[model samples]
Target chain A: MNIPPAYVLTLSGILFALGVIGVLIRRNAIVIFMSIELMLNSANLALIAFARTFAPAQEALRGHVFVFFVIAVAASEVAVGLALIVAIFRSKESIDVDEVSSLRG
Target chain B: MDWQDFLSVLPFIIVAGWATILLLVDLWIPANRKGITAGLAVLGLIAAIAAVISRFGIEREAFDGMIIVDGFSSFLQLLFLGVGLIAIAQAYDYLRRRDIERGEYYILLLYSLSGMLLMASAGDLIVVFLAVELLSIPLYVLAAFAIPQADSEESALKYFLLGAFASGFLVYGIALVYGSTGTTALSGMVAAIASAETTPVLLFIGSGMILVGLGFKVAAVPFHMWTPDVYQGAPTSVTSFMSVGAKAGGFAALLRIFISALPGAAVMWMPLTMWIAALTMAWGNIAAISQTNIKRMLAYSSIAHAGYIFMALPAAATPEVAPEAVRAALFYLVTYAITNLGAWGVVLAMEKAEGSGLTIEDYSGLGKKRPALALAMALFMLSLTGVPPTVGFMGKFYLFRAVIDANLIWLALVGVVTSLISAYYYLRVIVVMYMRDGEPEVRSEALLNSTIILTAFGTFFFGILPGLLIKMINQVGLLDLLR
Candidate 1:
């Protein structure tokens, strides 16, 4: 039994929307990080679904290839982002985005 | 993959290879004796510039169609290399003054410049995504380089979070675009779109998402919430470098993607840009007037400039106007880079010890104390306001001309009106400097001062004799490539 690519795409779209909403509402910097990860994962899923939808059987692998690159980039971003968060945490003693308001007008 | 690819990307190879080697070499250098790194980076930039010059007029697709060497990339590469050199010089003085001069900063800058150069030439969406990440990660690290400052760290965190979020959007957009077009290559996508009479809805949505991501990098209004805080909270040197470097990279990709790849969908993108450009100008100018902090003020002012650059996009849709549109863009970036970097150089000159002397009030009485420096600042402010006898005016003239030619006269009018609104704040800086009475003296660094004088000279000299640059832009065929 084969699953329709539309279902995968629909699921990915829902996940991406949820991720965007989470980012907008989340206050904690860590939670924001998680939200961004969710967004990236949804993009990965969408790419995979699209890859399968393309006519050529070999072309579908490009989506999987793109997914690998996304995961690698996401990991690196998280590494540097977490380190930056720690630096901020050391200085301000809080990871809440609200507390990081010293920069605003 | 071939000798042609190697020659095409010679400059990129030179910078990336030099930077990676330097990063390893930096580990052996004594921590306190780190000034050598900057000298090495300067040498690498000069070498990279030479490579770029050598590759001129040798336009071709290389690196498996992921990159191209053309008049467009050549023009932008020159600007990025120049920006990298000035940023390094500015950083040396800034870091020395703060007693935080380190090898890693220059290394990071070279890497970022490599990424920017890559963006200038990237012909594939995957390459664009990779180049953006390469450019941004270094910036995030550099923004927080002043680890001791709580503000710097906070700036990094905010920038990183937002940058990553933007990256997610970019990738998702690319994915959707690929899904619709069945290819991630820009040239392929364009061909695909051309073959289809009506653009698929997915392509339009994907392009919009992609624009949102690029808009954030260029700090366009509504997406620019990260800008002021990051500019203010980051160290001045990083802020100044990014103001030009990041903006240019974003515009480079934007120009290639929209103007080069999707000219077929003008009806879809142009109106959206009309709205974005108008709002950005309005918001950037209006908000700049009330800012007390000079960096934040310039940040808003930079946003206003982005809108101006963006105003040229609609004009780029037509084949006849595309070359003029591109020339206007290249000229605008060149002139703005010179003027903005000079303005920031003056800001750096006026910088005192950490966390003080950064407000607009710091410029009070600068005319009496340092007439030359104040004069330089005043010139930059004038140029930024699109006043005559400065390159800023010339840049705007060409941009507006291009817009009018595309029948975007209303957008041109908006540009003129907002430039009028912008003048009030830009002139206010001049007012505060010469008119206000305080003992504001510029701290003179030989390198920083020279950069300021050179940029200021270019601003005035180019404004008076812009035909020379116009000839160069024409020679680059910046306008001729679109048809």
Candidate 2:
């Protein structure tokens, strides 16, 4: 049994929306980061689903290659992001996103 | 990839490879002698600038069409390298004074420059994504370079989370565009899009999402919440480079993607960009009037400038006006880079050891204490306000002309009105400097002073004699924009 591409894309869109909401509403830095990761992974899922749907094999391979790049980029982002979070935590003794608002207008 | 492919990306390779090598080379350099590292970074950028110049007028697709060498990329490469050199100059003395002078600062800057170079040449959506990430990750680290400081660390966190979030939207948009067009290579996307089988809805949504991501990068209004906070908190040196470099990088991608890849969807995106440009200009200028901190004010000013540059996009969507719009935008970017870098250089000079002397009030009596510095700052403000005898005026002159030519008269009017609004705050700096009274302590480091002097000369020289640069831009004005 094959899952339809539409279903997968719908799920991905939903996940993306949820992740955006999480980022907006969540106060914890790490949780907000996880939400961002969720959004990335959701994109990856949509990419894979689209890759499976594209007819010509080479075109599909492009999507696959793009996924690899995205995954690599996401990993690097996580590395830098967590380092920043840790640094902020150390400086402020808290990782709450709301607390890091000293430089406001 | 073949040698030609490598050669096409020669500048990017040199900058990235030099940065990587410098990372190791920096390990052995003594802490006090990090000036050597700064010098080496300058050497690398100069070499990269040479490479970029060598490729002038040479247009070719490299790495299976993932990147392209053309006038657009070459021009921006020079600008990025130029910004890199000035950034190093700004940082060298300032970092030493603040006691955060690490070799990594230059390396990270070089790495970020490489990313921007790649961005200018990216011919595929995937490469665009990669370039954006490559450019941004280093900036995140650089933002928090003063890691022990709460403000710096907070800046990094905010920039990181927001940057990552923006990229997520970008990737998803790419996925949707790929799904709709069945291709990620920008050159091929047009062809795929013209084929009747493609889904227009998905493509529209995808392009809008892509715009959202890039809009965040360029700090266009409604998506510009992070600009003031991040710019204010980050080291003034980094903020200076970022204000010029990252915004140009984002425009490079936006112009490339929207004009080259998805021109077929112009109807859907044109009005959207036009409205965005108007709102960005209005919001940015209006908000800047209320800013107390000079950095934050410049941050708003940068956002306003982004809006002005963005006006070229919708104008370019008109086939008859495309080339001129692109040229106008390119010219404006150069002018903005020169003027903004000079302005920030002055800010860097005024910055104190512990971040005192940054408020606008600190600039009082600057004319009396340091007339030359105050004069340079005043020139930058006039330039930013698009007054006569400044490159910024010429930039806006060309830009407004193109917008009017495209029948975007209302948008041009919006630009004019916003610029007038911007003058209120920009001149306030001048007024305070010459009109008020306070002893403003400023650093007079050789490199920093030189950066300010060079940029000031460029601003004044180009403003009066913009013909040479305009001719140069005419020759290099997106010759392959439709290819």
List the DockQ of the predictions in order.
0.72, 0.87
**What would the per-residue lDDT of candidate 2 be over residues B251-298, giving only the tens digit for each residue?**
999999998889888998998899999999999999999999999999
TM-score of chain A of 1: 0.92
**Lowest-scoring 10 consecutive residues by lDDT in candidate 1 chain B?**
B474-483
Expressed as tens digits, the lDDT of each residue in B1-483 for candidate 1 is 878788888888899999999999999999877878999999999999999988777778897778977888888899999999999999897898887788999999998999999999998888888889889999999998988687887788889989988998999988888888777878877888889833388888888889898999999987899999898888899999999999999999899889888887777788887888889988999999999889999999999999999887878887788888989988999989999999999888888876578889989999888989989999999999999999999999999999999988788999999999999999989999989999875688889989999999999999999999889878763632363
Worst 10 residues of 2 chain B by lDDT: B474-483
Instruction: Write down the worst ten-residue block by lDDT for model 2 chain A.
Output: A83-92
> How high is the CA lDDT of each candidate model?
0.88, 0.93
> Which predicted model would earn the best lDDT?
2
Each prediction's TM-score against the native? 0.98, 0.99
Q: Give the chain B TM-score for each candidate.
A: 0.98, 0.99
**Model 1, range A4-100, lDDT digits (tens) per residue?**
9899989999999998999999999999999999999999999998988875765566677788988988898888898888877777788899988
Off by over 4 Å in 2: none
Name the fnat for model 2: 0.86
